[model samples]
Target chain A: MTVVATDETGRATPVVSGYGPSFAEQQPPRNERRSPRRLPRGLRIALGAILPLLLLAAWQVATAFVPAYRLPSPASVVLAGVDLAQRGLLGVHVGISVQRVLLGFAIGAAVGLVLGALIGLSRWADVLLSPTISAFRAVPSLAWVPLIVLYIGLQENGKVAIIAIGALFPVFTTVAGALRHVDRHLVEAGRAFGLRGVSLLAQVQLPAVVPAVVSGLRLALAQSWLFLVAAELLGSSMGLGFLLTDSQYNGRLDRLFLTIILLAVFGKATDAVLGVGERALLKRWT
Target chain B: MTSTTALPVSFRGVGRAFGTARVLRDVDLDVAAGEIVAILGPSGCGKSTLLRSVSGLDAPSEGAVSIAGTAVGPVDQRCAVAFQEPRLLPWRSVEANVALGLPHGTAKEPGRRRVAELLELTGLADAARRRPREISGGMAQRASLARALAREPGVLVLDEPFGALDALTRLRMQDLLLDVHAAVPTTVILVTHDVDEALVLADHVVLLGTDGDLPGATVRRVVRVPGARPRDRGAPELVDLRAELLAGLGVPAHHTAPSTAQLSHQETA
Candidate 1:
């Protein structure tokens, strides 16, 4: 039963397992990784890391012996990727492409959410908007490329328009579908609790739709990247897509492989971030 | 009834019908403040619909529903409902789902306390952090109870709340509900097809029978239960009453007798 004096000479309480500042913020000790000598987690991670390394090694071995036109060796392509990244030219193109994708994604997502929610919320809105949206969506993202290029010129607007178009429909369709399935019972429950109109929508329906919307966003993110490459090929000065196209003119297969690998990794990274968010959200309700 | 200012719930001339079928006809029921009333009925009877009307999930086609004399058209925050299925958000932790039922304006610290209190009250204190999928059906229902009680409603409406539990669990829930009701003194309107449950929990018992023409309909008969508080589940009088209700429900007088207290399997199966 001893008290300790701190810097200000104020009395300090003794720390005990369940009786200290830590006690105030107590949580169950997390289950230990539980491998006196190690098991599932280490094995899983090792397996994950090893597969990619093995693939790269195999690809490099094949490329070293194979002719240059078809496939570049893994080491050379990685080196080329590093060289492109360091040159500042690759960064400029990557930066502009990223900016266009993000800006377009934001705009498309915003518009999609509003329209999707509106249609999802009401039969009248659904009736008015569904057919037109379906028709527009049926026309592929690439088909809009020519039209947008003609109207806005194949530059910033065209690339952005392409990404926006690519990102929009998935989000829109997902939101609409999610809205449709967003638990009729919960909405009625909200209304019963004196929540009406917009309050009901905001409080119950919107949160319910989030997981589905997140799924759509994940799809849209992947699609926008694919569409970005296609748009860049038409008339963008720089981008991962532009890099690929420009490399093809001189048949620099190494740079093409590098950009393609970057796209795959970048798309996977977006999916990973999305997976994190989805897990977090699912954790909230379940 | 209007003169009884203390009464928290009052139903007047409440009649409901769909197309040509009548569910409730000129129904009049009143729940005194802190009183618990159980609505007992047969299958296809509108016991659920009646409870839904009280919950504002379904509006009575005739007459009106009022809370402290305020006519209710839609569900209000003043009452909380627990369904048979534990219709939870499925994405929220037990605690967060419980917290969601809280009225928006409540301050955080006290609201958190209330959520904790409800969790503890429902015997779900340890499972608050668990997800619905991670818990047993009993625990999920317990969380559902916590969610309903978190609102601190003037009226607590339950529709076969324990009709899904195992026999032992259902008995435990019945007792738990009785204890909680004693503590909170909120007007509880429990709808069930279990006459034993109605007798044990209700200060007043309402017997409901089906209307022949109505495919999805019901009508209720109010039966006042008189005896000491916490009526014994094993008592002879309760057994007789339950049997009478069964007869009223069109079960043959000599049918297989069920322990009405263990009513969970009866209704669901």
Candidate 2:
């Protein structure tokens, strides 16, 4: 409450709030200032399909000009693909492959996540099981093919088990890493907010690990495809992989090429689905 | 300790040491019903430790911490805490994030209703559809505050809630907090390093500083804040009180004299 009379005009100077003038906060960084973006309605869908269309066009052009024996053109592949489809061979093959992958992938992911969580959650668990997991990771997916068939045989169960073993480790490792790496500050904050016990894990801890889990699932999906193909190659009466092997043995280059194209399309299609699911679930997150 | 019924919370002779580093020693605090007590101290002075003790995140090495007539151990719905950062579940929508504090389905209907009411109170109703990442820091923090409020608890603990915000936003938040205090009047314990923030927001400003011999520092003085809600900073007594707090905060003597430019700027803005 001091009023000093030290002004040049011999008037009193009033003491006021020390806080400086609040200017119109300057416009923020240009990139930070960008307006929200949206793809024009239906444009996203159209744009997504464009690359495939172009690729298919190029494949058709190549096949039309080149020898059937070398490239076997898109038209011939489609004809082969359709011919295989009508004979119930394609459907049966696709069904067996899909079944093998889904069955193996589901079991593997479940076991992997639970086991990984146990290891991640406890130092003792990590000490005991961590080495075992790392050792198994070094063993290639195909290496399990002979052992799995020897133990479980050429039955569906055997193939499924092999795929599961192949897919499981990556999912497990990633989930563990995700859970381990999730910010501890967040967990502590959850504790402070009166969320203890089961609620704490469900509300706070579990969520922190989800993005990583989704990423793991994406990887596992890829492994499932790889495992399926490998399993079918080792021994299978059906599946695209079996058909591919069967066609190559018979010198049906067109059918073999057709299966490769089918495999690529299917792999991409599955990846697209996973990407969509991930986006939908994570939209609210960040 | 004998008059425990009058105070909702009390920390008695509490002390904590981690490894060789002692964070707090022989500290005691009491929060009566419907009062705002702010702890102001430098970083690492153990104000946060004390706050954590009150919530039972860390147990005291020596004595006891009691909340709502119960001893601290596991956390419960009786007390809610907000940190400087908004610790919202990123997977949830703004509305769902607020609702998560409500017990499972106890939050189902009431949670939805409260989310709306609370969002409106926090001026975040329009952002209900957005994700945590889709919002500004202030808005995300607003959602966090709303989430904490969902439990309708008797005790609210805040650790430098607005410390991360810009000055203008912090000012607005301070006013909003005062308004919230007026409406709900819960017993609030706010921790801050800024002396003016403590003065403006607390009913009692507890100064915790390192001049004490204890590792976590000790509560050296507790100043009783006077007057009603929405106190005018321009009032003569308030000006003096601010000067005293600024002195405590080590504001330079030259800068201690209020700048005339600020007053003129405030008028124009």
Candidate 3:
């Protein structure tokens, strides 16, 4: 009887195609071969672009029915961006937003990692800190703004504090949860080999949670962007969020559309960069 | 590499209890320097707990375990263990994972050289750069063994290291283990359920079992197998010993011939 093997894609191929004892002699030596069903990279990317292009077309069509003051055409939005670029105001706004996001995300994520590790590794720390942290997390991001502005007085530091608060919880939650679930067998093995405390965490526990850590970082970054807008809208002299409010008050619908588009592009661009790093980390780890 | 000075390990009235449940009771055994001892027992007999005590991974509640006349500490530096599963770090390559077993504070150059030597000895030279997930089960186990040896440990603890491999691979691994022991000459404590494996590799086979109505298992028998390294598996003496061991384990003897009286009576009928 011939034996059959089914690959992950639900395709069955006979492992030994013929039913005789000499089937092994008849078969060629097995070697690495790529699956025929996979689409090419270029084709996959093109497939992904199709939906966005369709949405753009739909938006362009909708502009003809709506008044320009209410809903600017895509071409007019592009013109508004060109106008801002020529005046150099667009660069200043975009740069400031990017800077704020990076700074706040860095500080928040670093603190979150340390605190999360402490809470996850030590039962005493968990018992002491978890309740207070949960109460803080329950307060909304916007709720921090009034208190932050009162203390820091609408400066860059106040805006940064808001963004940092936004970025903190995701990293803290994921890192702590992930650490608790690292394979017990692996930890025991490491301990058996003379690993203890910090060395054990570095060699085994931390590396085992790379995938979760990366995902946490990604979530933290997205939150940074969200809180950046909140902080900027409240009290920024220059930023994409400021541009958003300024355009709305000035009734420049075209520039308002431009700001929204820029936000989308920048957010996706940052996430993509993180995605590349995540892939590299997961390759080395899991 | 210079030959490691194997340290003697001793257990005095060792017993273990988890909460109210006892697992081992009054277990006493002494391992000579550079000797191989196999602990064979049924499931739940605390064979693993006994080995873990030697490595200082688990402490016996009632008694002490000592290495070289010094009581074992919370995390004994004198011992290294290869568990039933490979338990290799998936993130690390085989070479790096093996390097992790090197004793703390080893110099960089020496550590690298030691890792290389173990990779070669374990027949993992080509797969040194490969991650744990890339290698086969037997290869992973060899890497685990190599990792344990990289410590140059006084006592190497193996808890069913070859139990997960196929029969052919298991035989090959047993031989590889012999080779490793010949090179390092460290004290080894092996826990296994396979009777044949115990007879093949150990100088002394220790059987652990519960006595009468005892709550916990203890040392039931210790048989010193005759002959030196690489003894004949099918020798008459070994075969007879195998039968006796099987009988002691409550296994009935197989393939015995009918008596002459029964055969003659059947023919007359």
Task: Say which candidate scores most in lDDT.
Answer: 3
Q: Which ten residues in a row have the lowest lDDT in candidate 3 chain A?
A: A2-11
| Docking quality category of candidate 3 according to DockQ thresholds | incorrect
Model 1, A237-282: lDDT tens digits are: 6788888899999799999888888788877887899889987885
Scored against the true structure, residue B49 in model 3 reaches a CA lDDT of 92
Model 1 segments beyond 4 Å from truth?
A: A1-39, A45-66, A82-86, B1-13, B20-22, B30-33, B67-70, B76-78, B90-96, B99-104, B107-116, B126-135, B150-152, B211-220, B253-269
lDDT of 1 at B137: 66
lDDT of 3 by residue, A44-106 (tens): 999999999998898899988988888888999999999999999999999999999999999
Q: What is the per-residue lDDT of model 2 for residues A54-84, given as tens digits with 9 covering 90 to 100?
A: 9989988887788777777777777888998
The parts of candidate 3 lying over 4 Å away from their true place are A1-37, B234-236, B247-269
Q: How big is the positional error of residue A54 in model 3, measured in Å on the Cα after superposition?
A: 1.3
lDDT of 3 by residue, B1-269 (tens): 34578999999999999999899999998889999999988767899999999988999999999999999998798898999988999889999999989888889999999998888777788788988766667777888999999989999999999887766567667877887787779999999988888888899998787777777878877889877766666666666667666656656557363322121111100
Candidate 3, residue B197: how far the Cα is off, in Å: 1.5
Clashing pairs in 3: none
Worst 10 residues of 1 chain A by lDDT: A2-11
Where does candidate 3 chain B have its weakest 10-residue lDDT segment? B260-269
Instruction: State the DockQ, from 0 to 1, for candidate 1.
Output: 0.14
